[model samples]
Target: MVKIARWNHDGGTQSGFVDNGNCYALPAGQGVQSLLDAGLDETLDLARKVTGSATPVPLADVHLLAPLVPATIRDFVAFEEHVEGVRKSIDGVAGVVPEWYEAPTFYFTNPHTVTGTGEVIGIPAGCEDLDFETEVAAVVGRVPGSDGRNLTADEAHRHIFGYTVLNDWSARDLQRREMKVSLGPCKGKDFANTLGPWIVTADEFEALHDAEGFLPISMSVEVNGEAIGQDLLSNMGWPFAELVAYASQDSVVRPGDVLGSGTCGSGCLAELWGRNGSKTPPPLKTGDVIRMTVEGIGTIENSVGERREAVTRVPARSRPRNRVAPVVTAGT
Candidate 1:
């Protein structure tokens, strides 16, 4: 089913099934990896056997880490809403490129970087325009080219370890500046990528995802208890199979590698930041709590901070203050 790792009242960590208060240990201390390493039939059989022995950690009590801490995080720009939203903000980026329309466009991210759920996220100095990106990430279990060939859709299905929610934090200013040089989103995206509360396996929600591995997941972001961006996973343009096919072109996709559905159209400040004709997107200030949720996946609640600085100077890009930097970066 939905396998997860957690800490208990005694401060001991254990791997278990996610249920309704306390986390009970799985007989073998196996988490999602165990299932991922298992074959398709074996995984499905295990799913039918394990009744959850654990309880839900009050969203605040549990700390969420990246589902797999992958070696590479590849974010795909395959959502039309995000494509259009980018166009609405920048003149030349409005329409989807013909190639992008036919195939998924993706980029690699720094796998070593990460942030846990409920942790305080600091805004990098000089990045006056930081933003959030709501997305669903797939954790890879099997590496491609194991048998001298890349993984096919069927192989890909068996290789998926689990799924988790991700918040691809963005520094719009830095991202734009870096892209202008034709290099890549080095400093912009490498700073931090928020992931997890738990890793929900593929079998747990068999009915949730379509044949192509595109699950109809609902997502939302709340700031200071107010709803900001929300949408369903159905809005995605390309399915996971297409992405896998694209990613495996002439190369291999590996285990613990992450494939992210780039920001769902309205799931960012650039899209939902302003109202009425003004472009003032409110920036996140210190002490502001942001709760990002995905139905069935889980919610990750984090507070904003400035590390050693005072809370008053932390920048936020919300409505009425849309002075946030422009959205001009490409995939990843």
Candidate 2:
């Protein structure tokens, strides 16, 4: 298996692969970004050269960072069960929207907030009901394509670089408020989204495909050592390729972009608590540890840290005001 990753080395971060409990840097002069920039063929060739002959470093010696900073993050809600559970958790909400069945729906998240496994994530300020979402992500590669044309599922599928586990952390309270504004999720999700342990190249999962080419990997989640959620990647209504194809409709999917699978059914505390109503565990807080594992990719664990000091926003009077309404005038 070609498992790619980035780890702390020589006071800096470097990209490499893990093999037999050890780590080796990617062929000299190459880092995770470079590999992504190399596109598919060259990246694959370089990955193949990381053999047992290279000097190995104890995996224990390095702290892993997010495999790579995603150029863009397109998180999609592709699982019906997750939608149902979420609706039930919040008040007076119905099940999935009719549009959801027509095609995959996604939102772009703050790529700047991405982190890796083992990192300590602080709860976003003004957020109390912080939650963690468990899912998988496909890394978008820079496959040759002209702008303005959409790639079909078959064509887009080839643009997949690999897969990684995702913990799209959320501030439930903030998310509720923002989503209610008739817009999509923002600050509530912008703080942090964990990706890693490592990236398992797509070829490593070819054998795990089901009839529709959906990867049927078992996925599980645990918080503070307590098992909470388990499901299969196959539960997704729209597979990664379809989602990728839809996302690339007249848009560019650059290398290192992330296409998330959203949370699996029952894969998040909000869904469980919402579905069960008060019987589920409390929302995650400082010191809470969440561990999410995927059958082939690997596990990513993060500890919730104390909230940071709040930054004072510009006072209303001093801030720029909204556009002034047109002056009232006669019909003339």
Candidate 3:
């Protein structure tokens, strides 16, 4: 398996394969995205050639960056246990909605907010209940001349380049308030989404898939150096292929696009709080660190930074008058 990464070394950014605790640099200006765009087979061939020809650098010497700046991000609530747990916590409900079973549901998140492992994530202003969601994400790869739309599950599976550990940081207070209007988790989620220690190419997991195409890989999370929860990827209601295909329905997905496997069962503090009917595992705070790991992929660890004060406030507006008045009958 080839583990791909981008890092800062010798005062500049370099992209390469990481193996045996060493980084083998690709040629100047060539990055993981470029290799992906070149097609998967070629990318694998290049990985071999580059690692063989380049001088190795100690992995600890450089600072790693997010594996790639995603072209788009679509995060899905693919785990049934997560949905049920969170629904119970936030709404005082005990079960998932039927619509969730009909299709894989996803929301587009801010790709611009993507950060690397080891980076500090800041709490948004006015957010008291900060949280972390442990997940696995698939990075899309391009096939030459492909439109990347309305794909079959098999086709979508083939288009996946690699997978990485993800931390979808949340502001629960803001999320609850905004979602009351039934429109958003926007401001609540836009702050940060952490990806990487590095990306593990998808081919590495070929032997791990079950008969149903679900991966049984173990996933776990930690906070402030204490183990929080663990679950298997097989618990997802929909497979990664189905989630990718659902994202492409009547739409387009480009290379570098990311599809997240939402929070795994017992993957977040919010879910645990709901299950226990109390805040057993409390919300994250400034200076708290979160570490998440997927079996085949490496671990991603990040510290929470201080929350910033809001510079401007948005005051509530008065309700608007109805544009159409009721009409009275002539007899009345």
Candidate 4:
């Protein structure tokens, strides 16, 4: 089952569920992680039996926070549709790079980029072309090295703590400009990343299946009341297990870390704009509310805000040792 940590009116946190009309707070520390730790098979069965509580909390009354405060955010470029859409939207990229099909590609985003649902995202100054990416992020449940090496599909599934909805918000203008530099997607991407209203465990949809008999979840997005994105979980180019294996290639994955399945096929700017070689993407502006929904994972709604020029940074110090190194060698 999916689990979430919601804020009470008094600004306190509690475990919750995203059900019919409202969020029902569960017992303390009983979030998706806690439930998975308890037992994936049993916890989900228990979740289905929860009846309506007398005192229910309105979804609006509570703040949705990131399901997992991962130590590091590793995002993978998996879906061909998403990649093709992106290439087509931007000029000059009309075909897929052969290297992309070789294996999964990933990039690291600072963990601090994470924000909760309903929080106002502060746009960076001079950056007007903002965009959204809807992704399904898997939380690492177990510590690495269970088998003393990498894990297979069967072993990897047991390590999944839970799942959550992730919005990899973007600054398209900055991204486009930066693409020419040969560096990774940085400031344009580092600005902000969003997670949960809640987290859903693997067991939640034991019965939900795709046409191929694989477990599947439904996903969709809405912007200012208009439907903009939709897809099924089974359509991912690679499944969670393979993603885990790719992420753990060097034996680096750890618990509480997040692995994002980059934007789903129709989950980003490229899809709507036809990024394969044609189409210009629609830009987001202030006051636009983007809401994303994943079948068992719940919804995350955020609004664009005016860019604020708050440069929160600390000065870096140069080392005197570097300058003295040459002098020391000569003296010696």
Candidate 5:
């Protein structure tokens, strides 16, 4: 199976497939997103046809970019262990809410903020508790005439193009304050979300599926070269297919739509801090490097950049008056 990639080489961005430590360029201007829009089978066929004619470049020579900018991104909380850990950390409680078992839940994140491996992720202004979330994101493929909605698990599985490592960077201080109002994870999470190394086609994981439809692939995270935690993909409360299907319920999931498997068990510093009862490992600071690896897919590493000052700010809202309504006595 081929690993699809987008990179900068020769002062221009190009799309290609990487194999055996080399990258084979596809026809100029035909990017991973366009290939996926053309449909998965056709994309694979074209890659095979072009491989022989394409010149090989050493993988190290090219600068990688996010394989594709997503149509939209929906990140789900699918790991029970992660949920339990963070809940305890935040609320000083130990169990997941019962509602979580009834259905998989997710939130929309900023797609425009997506970055790739080796890039610098700037910590958002006013955010002192910067953190990284380790996740696996499924990239949707097109079915030519079909726009998927209300799909079954099996149908959703077919629309999946591939998987890649995702770093859903978080600004915990902002997230905490915003979430207290119960309307956000918004500004807290919108700053930077990283994807890539490359996209590994879904077919590559065919032989690894477990009876429960989970991949069982190993996943891990490290900070500043120190290994932090590891967990299996199979540990997810719901598999990728279910997450995709749930996302398509009454909504549309188009090609290039990304569905993230949230943070895996012990996948982020917040979860660990909650579990340990303190920030023993400490929050990420400027220049801290984060590296994440998924066994079958690949690894993505990014450095935290200096926080920048906000150019503008919104004024706080005024509190509403506690006005009482006058009662009308029979239309008086």
Candidate 6:
């Protein structure tokens, strides 16, 4: 299988296809963006040519970046086992709602906060409980009817440009607190998400998936160096093509948008704790390296950087008795 990667080489980041354990770079300063901009047929043609003519750069010398900076990111919760496991962690919640069966549930995250494999990421301010989520993500390409029509699952499946591993890094303390308010996960999850090792072009791996388009790769996570857990990706209840199709409904999903497969069962510390009823492992600490690997997709190895200094809290002032709220003015 050919792997596409963008790396720090020849003075700046260059994108290319990897074959024979060597990188065939596009050009100085150009990256996957150029390929996507060139369109599908052209990109494939260029990839083929470069792999043969370009000077092969051994994988060791290249510093890989996030395969490409995604235009947007949609992370969906599609694993039933993960859902059940997490529910048990809650004070009293149990079982999936009827709505879950009808449609996929998802959330938008900060696309700009993406961190590539091997990069160092820092903990969010005020966060003490850090965690990692193991997931698989698909990079979107131009779908035939993306703008004017809602594409069916078959059409959406064609738009998948490739797949990559995703580490939806989290600050559990902040996550639980914000999610309680039902409006956030903003500050908690926005700090950083890890993606990479590289993107395996759709053609390379799609054949491995089953009739329903569920790829049968093994997903695993290692903290510091201990194997936390691993599971076959086939266990996910919803296939990624369905997730992409769901995202395209009533909305436009542009090329470079990343749609994730949520976390696999027992993919994170939270689910593990909830499942075993054992003590939750200590949160990630500075200098901790986490390697989350998905068979065929490659491993995303990242370390927790230093925590930022906490910002001082501003005290709240009571509202004036005569102050008019914005809603009152709008009524006029």
Who wins the lDDT comparison? 5
* Cα lDDT, all candidates: 0.68, 0.85, 0.90, 0.73, 0.90, 0.81
Q: Worst 10-residue stretch by lDDT in candidate 3?
A: 311-320
Off by over 4 Å in 3: 311-313, 323-332
Segments in model 5 whose C-alpha atoms lie over 4 Å from true places:
311-315, 319-332
Best by TM-score: 3
**Least accurate 10 contiguous residues by lDDT in model 6:** 142-151
What CA RMSD would you report for each candidate?
10.3, 3.5, 4.0, 4.6, 3.1, 3.0
Candidate 6 backbone collisions, by pair: none
Clashes of 4: 9
Query: Candidate 2 — worst ten consecutive residues by lDDT sum?
Result: 140-149
Please, what are the lDDT tens digits per residue for candidate 5 over residues 157-187? 8898999999999988788778778787899
**Clashes (N, CA, C under 3 Å) per candidate:** 18, 1, 0, 9, 1, 0
- For TM-score, candidate 1 versus 2, the one ahead is 2
Reference-based TM-score of each model: 0.78, 0.91, 0.95, 0.80, 0.94, 0.91
- Global CA lDDT of candidate 2, please? 0.85
The candidate, 3 or 5, that scores higher on TM-score is 3
TM-score of 4: 0.80
lDDT for position 251 in model 3 = 94
Q: What is the lDDT of residue 140 in candidate 6?
A: 81
lDDT of 1 by residue, 13-131 (tens): 55555545434445666754565555335654554455433334453465445455566789987678776775445333445667767778787887777776877888876676677
Task: Give the distance in Å from residue 277's predicted Cα in candidate 4 to where it truly belongs.
Answer: 7.0
lDDT of 4 by residue, 1-332 (tens): 34645554556766656565567766655655565445555555556654354256776776667765677788988778788877766544666789988888889987887988888887876576788999889877653347313777667666666788899998776776677677778877998999987777766654674444344778888888988878877777777777887777667566667888888878876566764333344678788899999876778999988887665334568666645443456556
